[model samples]
Target: MSDRRILPSQLERMVYETIRDEIVSGALRPGEQLVEGRLAAELGVSKTPVREALIRLQRDGLVEIAPYRGARVIVPVDDDIAEITELRVCLETFIARDIAARRPTDVLEALETSIAGSCKALADRAEEQFVDRLSDFSDILAEACGNKRMKKILGDLRSVLHFIGNSSRRIQGRAARSIAQHEAILEAIKAGDPDAAAEATAVHIRSIAEDCRKAQVPNGDGRLPGPAANAPRAKARTRARANR
Candidate 1:
């Protein structure tokens, strides 16, 4: 990639995309500070565009801007994550049902392709890409549902969840299990079984939610506990809702 400083408009676009991608991909982990000067230098751009980009990212709930701390990635609280996952389960299950009812062969093929990629990502132990690829798969499903309102809602929900932190690495075999679920959904869709697809998708999301519940808690803790460990999660959720 070119390290050259871009023009004003290009710089703005690049800065936004770069920071957003880093945040979503988990390249910049949640709670990691975003040093404007360093980022500008790294991207070979001036701090002006970098600052603007940070503001934009803040609005997108991808970064938190504090008086002394500047900008940092947002991490979602247990409740917020749980809520988002619940919303996703509802929306995605509906999508699977609608798509299966319609029997869209092309969309099913696309989802299968995404599932294949997700399986490979899991096999390679690439958590970041795995989550992102899975998100793409989800987008396809939502789009295939043929409901604009649902798509918009799911898109906004995804933006909030992405900022919270990539949760794909929560369990060892979670990714593969997700892929299997996708396959099951695809099969249901192929069979023109809307009810079965919806059931499978809901089960898949619930399984992930269970895994996240485990991952978010420490070894011994069953539920989210302690103000100390929970502080970051609370802050992230507040920032996310505020930004939205």
Candidate 2:
């Protein structure tokens, strides 16, 4: 990638967001080294801003910084996926229940709009847009529940969840299934059925977790399987050897 300089005042936050988006979009694959100098050059910023961004990414659990080894994308293992899945199930189910009981018209309308956008994206085979809309759908429901703290927690988890979802949804039929699940949850909420909404949310999360598990790729050594094997880094390696 070419250098893209950030303005002085926006350096830190912009650098962090840029790198985070790259990681989430799989442009920076898992386990790929994030060299300070290289990222600085590519981002057209000084090493200082890049260093600060790496620290923030590390804090977000998206990167791991070693003392002398620099930073690398943290590969999401099965355990990591499972833990995130459980947390989402707990928080989102509660949010669904609350939203269902409250029955906020504005929130419902926002969710419907998101679902409609998602359907259009899927029909067009626009994977990125589809996932973005799905995330928006979840965020609207969570915000509607009116728990600021819970909403903040969910926001904190959004990047990693999106990364996982992007990987899992690549599987055949997974994206369609997810849309159906979201529809079910929305239907329950529209009907003012808290219990049904909660159940639907739980089921959706569990299904996503299962799909993520199936999408995991075995590690290079055929041990310690992780999601990294499915990443671009692995494909690059395969191509490198094939051309030899």
Tens digits of per-residue lDDT for model 2 on 134-161?
Answer: 8898988877767889989998998888
After superposition on all CA atoms, what RMSD does each candidate show versus the true structure?
8.1, 7.0
**Clashes per model (N, Cα, C within 3 A):** 0, 0
Model 1 RMSD in Å is: 8.1
Q: Write the per-residue lDDT of candidate 1 for residues 1-244, one digit (tens) a residue.
A: 8766435776577667776766665556666789999887666667888899899888877788999879987665667667877888788888888888888778978888888888887788675566767777777887777789998887766666554424444456666687788788889888999899999888877777666555455446443322211123333323322332
Give the clashing pairs for model 1: none
Model 2 lDDT, residue 16, Cα: 79
Model 1 poorest ten-residue lDDT run: 223-232
How good is model 1 by TM-score? 0.75
lDDT of 2 at 231: 42
Candidate 2: list runs displaced more than 4 Å: 1-9, 219-244
